[model samples]
Target: MVFSKKRSFTMLAALLMVSLLLSACSGSKTDSSTAAETDKASDSKTLTIMAETSSHADAFKSIIPDFEEKYGVKVNVVEMPYDQYQQHLKLKFISDQAEFDLAYVPIGWVPEFQLADYITPIATEQAKLDELELDDFPGIDNAYFGADKQLYFLPYMNETHGILYRTDLFEDAAEKKAFQDKYGYELQPPQTMQQYKDIAEFFTRPDENLYGVTLMGENSILSGFGFYNRLFNYGGDLYDSNYKQQFNNEAGLNALNDFKELFQYASPAAKQYGWSDASSEFLQGRSAMAEMATTVAQMAQDPNQSTIVGKVGFTAIPANDANTSDIKRFYLPYGFVMTKNSDNQEAAFQWLEFATSQEMMEKAAPVGNIPARTSALTGKLASEYSFYKPHADIMNSFRLETLPLIPEGSTITGEILPNAVVKYMFGERSAEDALKEAATEFDELMKSRGY
Candidate 1:
């Protein structure tokens, strides 16, 4: 009886083991199917976007809820400070660890990103291109192309440097007449550097409440670009086709001297000023005029930030010379790019298309950014925004010239020239001495990079 019972127990154990195996197989199949469904749901659509901290981004986020409701996908927006965003992005792309799927890049930085193989070309979607009206975008769609002609980015915001003036201060007919009498022209916003200088000088009353022009005089890429914009307008180029430093010439010296001459009338703190300081002083009614980015139009009109709301006027950057033929114009374009490390290329492209689309422009234009799309500018969207109309008019009137689209353009403008220009501006060195010294340093830097 004991042997029979032990044999039955052994058989019972074997039967239980077989039943467990069958259950395990069924569970494995169910798990596999659940995982496949989860992956399919995840693959439906999602985009992670990195954007700069601009009023534009705020407007974008405000409308994202609507975007999600219309489209089936969700968008995650990551806003970053302007200064640190580029470095953060570079780190993300280099490590192939970017959490974000798309980024808003300064149009000039496209080359650097492309050189690192971080960004994918927009032309990757030929079918999407056929559906989108790319020609509606202003400036150059090809601005993001590499030397080999690969489209790596798309312009999200088309910006230009323009004059932002206090209309309340200049509205007096007598003051306007006096300005015209002194300068031999109407007291309109200047079209030439000489006229700009005259207006700056005319408006300056250091002992009174107001001063003359203020600019971004701090040593940074923006400052360097500002100086070069003037220099280029004055017929100076940083490099020839051979990539040699040619800014040590007379045109450069003249540009430097022109910049220096403004110190007599500019605010005493101009040396410490960047875009923020300049914008603040101008908005606070501390300065008569300022050369500023087009985005300042919103700030100038905002009742919250500006004391001179609805009393601000806009105009193009002053030409270098009196002759229209000799005038040189340059504007920097800012845009969006997709990183190569992004796993969701299609999603990223869709987000880029949407952000740069007419719909987004309608939301963004009211916030004071110059929309990249011509349709957005000409459409009811721009007309509804009282402040953007003048800026749009100015942008449309010009062909929009820009510096050469090269990889080293940012470094040259930001690192090399800004320091040299500041040193000259502060009387630390003469313009010639500063330019000569800077040229030597820049040449060495380029050589080290094997440029």
Candidate 2:
């Protein structure tokens, strides 16, 4: 479906303008444009960055020693788990107790941060952005702009969701012949839901101690990412155009039902699996397939952590054969944003400049990073890695857009929606009821905020 970028960008400010800031942690933001840097980055001896513990963070982080020697500054990094990252950053910023100079922001949090005025508008850094060739990164975040059309962060890495499976198993002569005889179809990467299910079931051999898939069923925003991949595949969104909650309908039900089916083929312990857990299952060669954020799945390429490095194969998420829908693949942008209340804005910008430079992006690429740079994606790495072309195709797709942007976005995905999804997966509720509960609660929140 054509998710209207223009439409969403226009709605960004209007949707978030009325969000009530936390009164307990009230603080003022610096006026970066006209004011002098609170501490000149050049004079600052130390810089602190808050990052989530992920490949994205490690890409730039592993090379920080080079930055320190070049700039002569100490860089201290605080890493948080994905589940805790949001709340921790929010409390830190809203309470006026933030010590972070810059943090790599996920796309979902940009609107909330902008609406709450927790970050500085970095329009003044246009020169640095130009030097870094900002256009080299995916432009999805540009369509999520606020009323001022200002950028609040620097883009570093972008990724989308796609399927990863074992090529070794799929290509095995004996296994393929057996799969063909039993399933009556070629045993290759899944292109249809029925094929996906059959292959998942085929690979599920309990005696071999291997399951079919690594289904991440964690009860957090990770579930949102997991569920929304299915939701988007079925042409479902969190809300309809009228600001009405419509996900309790057919598309939503179908997406949620996917989990119940996938559950049968994944590890019984997958009931509690997060992305990290799910990837581990696949990396250790214990599971056959996993739909992963493109960059996260790059872990399969690491010889240190992965037993199935060369065996891994990548593909787009398969669709239900009945629904001839053009899906928007799950995509997100991660980048560094300077906190308005930070004491080290100047140094943070310097770090951003260094991290996103073309040279640095290329450097990060070889170090197990899916760098968000045009050159990196289109360069020799595209031929070196099996997934780079697919990743680039999703980014360059005209249909590419972001997930819904609203002030209550975090609550909808992180809490309400995922909770209901988990309940449905555990058979605590029917698909309809679970989605209804989530959609209703989301509507109430938006209404209370005057959306």
Candidate 3:
């Protein structure tokens, strides 16, 4: 069924806002009232930006003065908590007097927004697109494009899930010797799901207050993503071309069972862990490895925040046997959407181009926004960090077809499928039963939506 966009956005936003800093704008000398005094009075426009109160929001605020000064415009940034950001925007879009010109959109919400005519194509202006260096943002543009093949959003944060492990733990003399004696292979970052499991099992030592992996086992977004990362590698898909559920098949069963096995090697609180707890486990040196968003790479190396300094390593998630060539992983893109109902589309597009440019991306990286551009990954600062290049590589190699592109995508990803994972993980149902129930629920949902 069509998910209540208001409610679904609230839930998804809450989960994502945890790592964000809820701060207001710190720069910008130009206020909305002074728009006409800055430059050509007739060309000046007051643009209001509605974005989630996050690190990216903070970065956007920091750069406002630059844009306002250069373009002779005023930007009023209205930051909302994650839970209210989407609902607030939706309400504004449907109103007779919609106030926002630009919005920070999560990729999963793109289809619903486009279908409701809440957002307009960012690429409709070809000259603007070329000037923004849109081609530099590899593996992200298509995710924001509408069904008509028009780009509707610009990439802000480009994230992919991967293995973050302790380099020291993997290279330890004693641990390496023991691992080789048992598994008959060099102890290193995993290259296959089977090897990943074996390493997790080998490293587990609850008595020493250490766990092999830090799994996001909560019933929210992260856990669901964990399942998808494995599900894709194992050749399981959420739905087939006909929009029929396919996750109840053999590949699905194997993926779910393998995911369950991981919990046994994870932290004791893994069932309650979301993205933060999982990453914190690795940062605190309580977990030897973690499968999480690449955004945490810089955080995991900050000496003030992490104990694992100079010791973290990253790699793409391993593939299952049959699909070695089709490595599937999550690509959660955060981007900017220009509202179709706005009065100042041109000004908003200018702000969007500046906010998502290579310069802004590089500046935003230290604050938590993963760079969506290819140049940022190979740039000086990114090159200094061992983790950035590999993460960039993984993002480039992601299977574009893995995530569901339907209008009900958010509901399925952020709610329905995740509920089934909780049931199966808690042993309340078998893999077969859990997926079967999920398939039935999805089928009914699609039918009710007139799919």
Candidate 4:
């Protein structure tokens, strides 16, 4: 699933504060109903879950039957579009509606959920942790819960960007010779940002209705993610160690300029592209390359949806001049968050454990769900999946460290900074000016939140 903007921290904090005040003056009317539901859950054999209708849902469907047979519980899963899932969940939570027992949460949403008390710590039922094989998920517990050291969600999938390119184009003898003659290097997957640009420009054939690369030019969270991935790879940080804004540096400028250059080589509709648009561009053989999540590897190879089925290749995103690593990738782990007010915490946790178990993840691996569990990621399952090795290697070696893990961190990364990228993309502001605007907003947010 693609990245989507989280609720703004300023708004979330204000809403939560109001919720607290309201509950203080008049007790929660749902409390008694919630207790009743808890008792009902213990006797009933049904549970509800809300999740994104992506590959994850596909895999969930396959394994859900087994879980249901084992627990004798019927689970009704409500699948929603990725863009709507966050806001939908927020509405349900704020309204004190226990419409679902568990939710598939993006890691970036954990802090917001925590602030609203929408999710309970996984530690509440520590005994279940052992049975789920907690140690199997290396770096996951830390990656998702390191900020407050409270495990609020069970890791389901870890997503990171990778280059999906047309192998047939790279291997064409005539094109290869021409590329080498013109660029002085073998035509292959790019290892550096400059090489990436050169290749994009080289393959650009606009008259033929084809272009070089697919640009995530939409002024939304995907655009933000697209920009920050490059910004970080270019040695830029959203903020310094002390949490002050620092994206107005040379690295940010270079990254932005490089990103802008790709638009010239991108499709005419590049300005409207998001993650799905980019994926479609590569799958339909419209562009030479696309930067997308590793999860797309399966989709790119599927004969039904892709014309480039056997011609696609996967690799890490290119590195900037200052960065030593050939591929520096940022990862966001998706997990299952059990609502704090769930009447059936026990049953919900059981479902949570079942969903994230190594066994279930192994089953999902073939269908494009990248496992967060070290055992699952490195086990025979990954080896059997043709596209998993390179992604696994990138995950192990080149994980990009992102912004500080403060409560407002997701808001900055997912919203404020992204809005700046949108501004620059639309010619409303220069790169430096846009980042400066974001920096000012970031500082004010952090200060207001008592950072």
Candidate 5:
């Protein structure tokens, strides 16, 4: 499942938001009605889950039969593209036509869903909580547990944003020697912003129709995600601790300028790229590297969808080592949540428990679904799945955060800041002016929402 431009975590014009799941082989566009082939067993109850198209759909297929057999529930995952899914769900709720018992929600949407009273907390006994093995998820309490001590969301899939590069190119003798001779250092994955640009410039070759990196510049939200990720990389934030606008300053300016500079080494078509487009450019061997989700990085090893299998490597995105936060990872927790209108909350919670169980996650990992469980992400499974170890290490050791889980979070995400960055990149406005204007818009939005 390549990313969409619509939702933030769709790992979306993904900055400031996201909702993506496994990579290109996911057949993420499959019809909901056919997602699961339910048995025609007598006296079986049916539960419908509103979800985005994902390889998780494929992973879930393998577990549905077992869950159905044990629970006597026939599950139907009603799927849609991430770009349209958010508005679709909002309309569903507004019209009271939200018939699904459960939904796969982008964590960024949690606040809006909460403020709108659209979902119910997953109320359960201590025994059930213990059975869920909640401790297996590192960020669960901060992300989904409410002040009232009720669980509000269940994360089935989660990810970190990082760099994906061509290992064969990095490891090539001729290339490494040339790079070292030219740059005066070992040719390796970048640890700082300068190294990233340096590596990109070295690999860029227009005559060969290749470039240093593939980037997302089209689709405001998608581009916004790209810009924001850069902003995050430089110890910049959309807002400061007091919730004041702060991305117009030094670090933000650096993030914006650095984002524009990368375009110089990307394909001219880079200006029109989104996550999926950039992903394809990297996967098809058109570029040396790409900044994408850990989930997307897994596809680099899939023989069916990648040309660089056994020749790809993933790592944390580049940051200025001297000036950055310990949180090198971008948080994209796309998972399932129980809907308030559901008449089958208990059964839905049961599904959430069974689906996120350690057993099921380990089963799902091989199919490209990154498990949220601690055990599933380490030891044996981590060894088998190349993407898991880096992601697991980041999750366990680092502090991660997403966009403001506020009712107004959606309005701030997707385009406002990214569009501004693009205007500056196009020479239509000065960087200072563009950021100042965007920051003004951000502050106005917060005020209008009574934040």
Candidate 6:
């Protein structure tokens, strides 16, 4: 769908932040020591960078020839799956024998990497710092900083969530009129939770071979967090300010109940669905709507992948209150960092800067990944790329929120929260009972870790 007024503000804020950062970069000069070091780069130095196996990996690989040609250095690019990457990185760092100079890491893993001393903190050298202004990459800078506020890693890409709907199903004037008449409101995309539910219910006709919604509901850590997104937006959070888990409270109960209620209108196989299953359902036209990442927007519109190519529309996650003018959304950053135990610190820093550079992001944009740099959001790369517009539009529409900045966040959300949600969703226990138990377990876990 077309971007709304709310999205315009988001775009402005992102652009303003980028402008401020670029101005700072222009004013700062590299220190002479760094300039001398950069000048002395010998052809013998070989830089190795570890990257995740994603759609963007090839785009990253595509730039190595240019990098090597310009710097007169040989580069080795290694790709690993997400699950094994962490273990391999830990072993390499603990033994102080890492083969790679740099590696890609999720922002959520920054704290763990920092505590394990797996990443080297960026040098304080004026020239090196000047090369890529921290201000330009505020999200990454914030993620890299420790509790005491020191920079450790750099961000390469930023990701967010949005809604995907079928325009063709609701395109007929008579059908639209009928929907509005039945629902007592226009049949447009929902702006609030009530509206979201209303729309889902309206589209649901299980016996007629159509379902209202499809979700990533397979029993996993992701399912729990996905449930939390809805719970928190409805004014409930997993924990209170005092570190007590509060999902058993009124807000949490209502949130869980609302989700459980929605399942009646979903596909029978939804319980088995993950990202692949949900996307396939939406693309194949078995479902009317899906809550998904920006990365999936184009896939839903592809003729080869979908039966409804020209009929897809987009919007941010529905709000809980229709009248609320501002909708807050979450932004997730994916990027790279240097381990503290690296044998070649200088090479790591150079490679880190190279991977996160605006120039490199611009080169990588054509391969279906969004760049973290603000400058990469518009112009030739955006216009030339097929899926850029929908993702950019969604990003521009919502205020970005991040997960709570706590050390035990992974364990608490990954292991503890999912068990509690499943019990509640399946009616094994009341929301109150499940959440109360989850809170106690989570608090104990955190306490044992000295949180």
TM-score of each: 0.85, 0.84, 0.86, 0.84, 0.88, 0.81
For model 3, how does the per-residue alpha-carbon lDDT over 1-451 read when each residue is reduced to its tens digit? Answer: 6779898999788866753433223222224323323322344387877777766667667778889898987887767667676676666667844556777867777787888887888766678668888778776546555557888878887767789999999989999999999999999888888899999999899999899999988887677887787788767888877888878888888778888888999987999998677778889999889888676777786787799988999987888653445666667777888888777888988887887788877876776667777787778667667888888777656565425666788778877888888899998988889888988899899999988
Which candidate, 1 or 5, has the higher TM-score? 5
Let me know the TM-score candidate 1 reaches against the reference structure.
Answer: 0.85
lDDT of each candidate versus the true structure? 0.74, 0.76, 0.77, 0.75, 0.77, 0.70
Q: Over the stretch 201-260, how does candidate 2's per-residue lDDT look in tens digits? A: 999987898999878788987777777767876778777777787577888898888867
Better of 2 and 3 by TM-score: 3
Better of 2 and 6 by lDDT: 2
1-451 per-residue lDDT for model 5 (tens digits): 6545555344434532322333343344345444432321222367778877777666766788889898988788778887878888888888986777888877888877776788888666788778788888867874564556577787777778777888899999999999999999989988887898899999999899789988888846667766776777766787766679868888778888888888998999999887778888898999988877876677777888888887878877766663444644457887777789887777888888888998888887678688888777874677667777777755654557765676666667676787787888888889999999998999888788676
Per-residue lDDT over 135-253 for candidate 4, one digit per residue giving the tens place of the 0 to 100 score: 77645544345345777778788777778888899999999999999999999988877898899999899888779988787877677767776787766777776877768888778
- Model 6, 1-451: lDDT tens digits are 6878889899999999999897576322224223423433543377666766666566676777877787766666666666666677677677876655677766767777787766767766667878876666535546656656667767777777767888877677886898888988888777888888888888888887888887766766556656676776766676777887767677777777777777777897886677788888888888888877765665664577778776677676766775333444566777777766556677667666776687887876655567777777665676554445655655565555555556577677766878777787777888889888887898788789876
Which is the leading candidate under lDDT?
A: 3
* Count of residue pairs whose backbone atoms collide, per candidate: 0, 0, 1, 0, 15, 10
**Model 4, global lDDT:** 0.75
- The better-scoring model by lDDT among 3 and 4 is 3
Off by over 4 Å in 6: 1-44, 95-97, 170-174, 240-242, 301-310, 323-328, 381-399
What candidate 3 gets wrong by more than 4 Å, as runs, is 1-44, 140-147
lDDT of 1 by residue, 72-163 (tens): 66776666678867777777777876755677777877877888787888754567875557778766655647667766767767767777
| Candidate achieving the largest TM-score | 5
Candidate 2 or 3, higher lDDT? 3
After superposing candidate 2 on the true structure, give the runs of residues whose Cα lies further than 4 Å from its correct spot: 1-43, 140-144, 321-325
